[model samples]
Target: MVEQADSRATSFKNILLLIADDLGKNLGCYGAEVTTPNIDKFATEGVLFSHAFTSTASCSNSRSVIYTGLHTHQSGQYGLAGKAHHFVIFDHVKTSPAFFGEQGYLTGLIGKVHVGPDYSYPWHVRNESATRDVAWVADQAGEFFDKAKAAEQPFFLTVGYIDPHRDMTRSGFGNSEIFDARIKDIPYEPSSIKVPAYINNLDESRFEFSEYYSSISRLDQGIGLILESLKARGLEDDTLVVFLSDNGPPFLNSKTTLYDPGVRLPFIVRNPKAAVKGIENPNMVSYVDIFPTFLEWTGKTQHAPTILAGQSIFPILEKSELVPESEWKHRVFGSHTFHEVTNYWPTRFLRTRRYKYHRNVAWRLDFPFSADLYGSLTWDAIRHSQPRGKEGDILVGQRKLSDYIFRPPEELYDLDEDPLELVNLAVDEKHKERLLEFRGLLEKWQDETLDPWLYRDGVSKRFIQHHLDAGMIVPDRFDLDLENIRIR
Candidate 1:
């Protein structure tokens, strides 16, 4: 509501955050064959962050990190929401929307409101659904923009597009919904697409990828409508626009895991009256950095720098220059404790510009499968493939079934040489120093975050409890497993 003529107050009065569900950097802007022209156009007019990442690859948990500026460990949204698992954000946590509401901005969230207990993230307006009807969602967003303008209030809006996410129907992306006439059905040819190395290039994968691309094009259409809404309302010049995805595609080895295909995201930010355009930044940024950036942009940061775990990238967006070595983040971290209720495999990852390391806490156990990935067409083909000859006919996407199921305690990859992360250099004597260095960085980060997942003698301290002298329930948020039980 601050209508001063000061440049800061004038330039960034509103915020529009557009989040796509289960999407990765597979857009035409990112050199992928998928048609995301609207988002690609936004990237061309905005600052495209080449190395943005999510702290977790699961849906609700990643969005929680973005909204709360906290890792899953800190926010307590350990997995998906609204289930028996009920991994809601911590009670004391202040979400991004709630903070903006405090600063007199009308906060509105349309489409996939995946994370909650209503009290935790109190968005002023909530229109939640699983519909891939992007146009309908855009219409709702346009209405929100109009309302905010009428009230003469600054607004923060998040439109979560449910496109490109797997449909409930098998081998579908919801592209055939006749009710969604606003989205034209654009079918992709299976043979024309370039399959990423992380996924198999089988007929089933190709078919499903076609559906995925079709859904992505629909999501792009929604982006265009929302941008039009902003411009029509005359808020385009005053709104700080950000577009990203909650996680990766709903395929095996991408959505549930912390691999590049899973965690690396497409982040485009079009700051109002920015100094640069179409600049690709290579700085290491994570979803946790988002909350702080919004706070800084709106001049609503009340907490000390120590409280927020992320550093604001407003300077980067404003200048588009390489941040000084001291100010730059050389590595980003991720934690994936769960995807669905049953997928309880805990893993932590640290990725530098050159190398990536993953520490699988439950390495002895086979990685549990998420329900969607287990039932995917891609997985079906990989699971049922037969070895024809002595060479084994290039096992499922060139990865052995055993390797996919079983994991070593530590994994290190030189991403420059192995972008696909097919090679594990953890045990290689030649890369031992690099592995140890990355591992040390990861452990240090864990300690700084006070992550209960920190292991001592191979057991996660997350299960252990302390301060028991007070009462029966000892009250610790980090005890996610509820292993600390005092006999009643």
Candidate 2:
């Protein structure tokens, strides 16, 4: 292993970030049953973050936070692929790539760059990349790296893979023919999969979970190829390689929700030159911390253009004396916006080490779990299962709006006991104080972050009304925001 001088050990001239779409803790390193030898190997040589999480659950929203290092409620992108309106991290400030480029690094992005409209940002080179073939991407990235090395310029390469997202064309929900059939042997049963009571268990749900495992394996193959390319080009030692996902698996109570499976992501960082190695850091970190951490790692201290809500992890990387847990146990927040044209469910979540609380603003009934208009037919079939008997008559007959109104508005879960978030303790009098405390904290965060959706009578209403006028959405029959809208 190449070691850096102790004085400049933290400095990195080149950085390579690999982001997998919809990749959760399915790899072998995170105790999943999937076969990800290459990813596991990488984890063994680097620091694996046990408590890393994203700021939002949806694609565009989470990517916005990752790029800008701000919460989704702060970035103003509460939905999926759509117009670039509201506040955006890239819009208001220079991105991590741009900052590194200014410091004499050639920065480029390969694969999915689903932040906003394609025409908005021009600073980074966006490659016309897709996740159809892992080998092809490895070959392309190898060529890019070789050219950058020949030019003698440090590079910031972001390889985004859209694997395992969804194959709406597939018959088995998330299954894709591109994946090796060996994935079928992975042990994942619906009976073994613990889900929340809010979601009805069905045969299709199990099939969907099985398909999710298959997709993860396929993406792992792509990651293997990328790592091999780096080693083949002899750039493994010099490059700071980081691997993570934008959000959790897209399933019921997962994607577009503030649950742990939705926001918690796999985070791994490997710097062969750094002093630290083979360590699992249990410290809690968020998407907001990435930009500042990258900046600090590159040996730059300039203030970012936008208001950064993240702190630098340079001290941790340097193997300094352990910081108090209270110092690092900061609250992480998340939010959701209009996912599809017709479906509107907005929610905010607050998470700590032991507890997680969710506040639903606009709930819907009879709506699909994921608003993936382009999702695979297999996923759709699994999500819309028929109720068995009159015992489920209420769930079977209600409209999406009615379901939303009847659902619990506040949810509190002790993550230590229910890592899967299967139980709710919000109504328990013993936990009432804790719920109120988190609610108060959430309200304070909302006010301080300038969340546009908090006040119903201000520009937020104007914004919604404007979208309504533009035919973006229709005022639903059970819209709760319209009834309890506060003028202030």
Candidate 3:
């Protein structure tokens, strides 16, 4: 990583990671009808990755993938980190923060530290808050930056913004609450917002989206405030800035599902060392690759865990198009187990450049909704909206309401033909070989990651492999046949 020729003298090396909660590709830079001047400015100067995807749509699991170079199923953070859910990362796994601290760097996190067992994420200065007060978060970040300068050590700070997520009460996004005066309120009207394709465009939905836009605008201001402090401290040229969202928007068909709108998110990286600037890289990358990318940036892979499941993407930091190189596979995978403790649905997926394959292990059961989505006004409108048919029907986005809840076991989508992923090509006779190839790829990934949800004869093979090894015979199939239950 060579630093390009510049007039400004670079002093310290650091990393500033900004993670926004429940934000999708609805920013002004993404060509959405939203006003985010601050974020857009950075996007103009950095590489805005158009096809970045998270390993899971659930927030905590998604964070785990970013912290450790592994998925939630392998890292042991399979669900939300709330006390009721109590999902914690495995103690044995080494997180990025821990590695940075070991290498004599000052690690700090402010606002929304969701992944825990607290010791696993041993930030040197941890000020975790859930407030949407972006200005206050910027203040804490400034103090941390000052501390790093005083200690003469490089800093690695992660600021998790709680904005843009639903207020969990209704169709609100903390707009009703008061905040620091430095946080300017950039309000939007429902008529000004354009709802995404994954959501039904209704009156209530539009109103809710307008509110979400307000929070996103506020988050952008907070980022600008923090970046200003970094520049004031003469660290702008010496730091790598990574910005992204945890998951998709908090909507019915997006949030907890394996759909593209749920996992595909806005990711931008502003590495000062890059020879080029403002490169719109089109390669598909995953959240699990984040830790490895950070490790490569800082040369901190010595103590990294041997079981890390992602490769560093730092080699192709400026490629505008997908590379034909073997190292850059142009593929990513997803793992989702739980959002809340009660919402248990294990799913895995493999996405290539043009095709996506989904394996829903719990296809027999209805997809459970997150509490926040269940109470939204958008959902209210969706349930009551009628179809113009002699036999009345309801639709969520372009998908049938029933299909959103009760899904097939195997789903394959050609994203080029169906960007919305409304068609199922898994059972199509023409794409049978394609489906089999992707299935094999996903199965190999599951085996490599040691996923417990890998199934055989309607049972988790990882849990029941002992019984089979003890001279017991079992059927070599995924689903069980009730008529042939006595097979030896």
Candidate 4:
């Protein structure tokens, strides 16, 4: 018993993960007009990843990717895991908290435990409470830290802050609530904020943007309090702290879609023991990389190359430099199957440094909306706005509203020229080579990942778990003629 305890004590000890709900890269550190001083200072004290993305834009599916080191399609977390949806992670998957528990770390989750079947994420301290109340969340975290300190046991705690996500009422981002009497909410003027280019400049959008900024400030305060607690307890140097969001801001075109505004979010890491600090990493990183990175950092990973779908960034953190000739450093892939149960817009994307390609499987159907976004004041404004020149034309950003709702089967964007993904480069004759190259890359990735969504004859036959008992077989090749799918 003594030997076991000593071994555990000698291993890399503490990990603190803070996740913000429905927040994009809207911090002062990220050049946004938001008051996120605490988070910006935290980035200044550590490494800030400039191009981190999620596999999916939905809350639970994205969290599942971060926890499992697998994409949403691989993990079977198709949509939100709220009671209404009940979409859970695949039973066989091993979650991060569960894995750490086996390593003798006391795993704790403070706020929203969204992705679960309780058995999947076996957190020792599951403190699900007033997530919007930053002060309350901090108090709970302090108590957990105190407990870990008393026991002298290594700890891994995840605090999910449910801020910036729209509240029950329309246009409410939990800003009106008095979370704590001592913590006053900072007011943001609508006219002064920089509206995201994805949404039209409307009065409703400005109102919601101001509300979102207020919630972000509250989240920043929560982070500061938690960091202070760690410092006060003398665990500041030992703990490897990480801060990121589940997905993008809760709004149309940003939250539920595979656009840059949806998938590209902020990622900051602060570890005093590591050599890297206050540096910005411009490499492309996916949420899938986080799991293997954790395992590598804690010395729990096997020497053999992992099939866990993500390479660890431990080397980059240790040397304070980009990985030499790393293919993953230049590109990342994403799979988004669903948002809510009803919001089924299956799409796959391959995002490179200079380009992004998206393959929309069900391109004919009008894009469905999440319940919250559908009821939002921003959507109301867009829905009720006057139609422009044509019959189905309404201005949504730089594109026609119909174009936003009814998308093509494939989309290619030159990220350099159109950062907001305003132009479709797929049909451009000049960029055909780039489009085909990215398309081939996306297909290769799908095959490597064994993505079951590879379809033939408009059916995902490859995903069928059971084959015919006698002689039926699924073809491994993606080259299927749509005109003639022969049954031999």
The segments of candidate 1 whose C-alpha lies over 4 angstroms from its true place after superposition are 1-12, 303-306, 318-322, 386-394, 461-488
What is the per-residue lDDT of model 1 for residues 167-206, given as tens digits with 9 covering 90 to 100?
8776888877864566677789998877878778888898
Alpha carbon lDDT of each predicted model: 0.82, 0.68, 0.88, 0.84
* Model 2 spans with C-alpha error above 4 angstroms: 1-12, 82-90, 117-120, 170-203, 317-323, 364-368, 373-406, 456-488
Better of 2 and 3 by TM-score: 3
Best by TM-score: 3
lDDT of 2 at 375: 62
Give stretches of model 3 more than 4 Å off.
1-11, 388-391, 467-472, 486-488
- Tens-digit per-residue lDDT, 1-488, candidate 3: 12332222255568999999999998888888788898999987788998899999999999999999899999999999987999999989989999899998999999999998899999999998999998899899999988987677889999999989998678999988899988888888898667888788888988999899999999999989998988897788889999999999999889998899899999999988888887789988888888888888877777667878888878777889888857687789989999999999999999988989999998898989999999999898888664422345578888888888899889999999998898999989999999989988998899888899999889988888789789777787677879888776
Consecutive 10-residue window with the lowest summed lDDT within model 3: 1-10
Which residue runs does candidate 4 get wrong by more than 4 Å?
A: 1-12, 303-306, 318-324, 386-392, 464-488
TM-score of every candidate: 0.91, 0.80, 0.96, 0.92
Candidate 2 per-residue lDDT, tens place, 1-97, comes to: 2343322322436788998888777678998766788899898888888878888777777877777667766766666665433323435555676
Question: Could you tell me the TM-score of candidate 2?
Answer: 0.80
Q: Which candidate, 1 or 2, would have the higher TM-score against the true structure? A: 1
The total number of steric clashes, by the backbone 3 Å criterion, in model 2 comes to 6
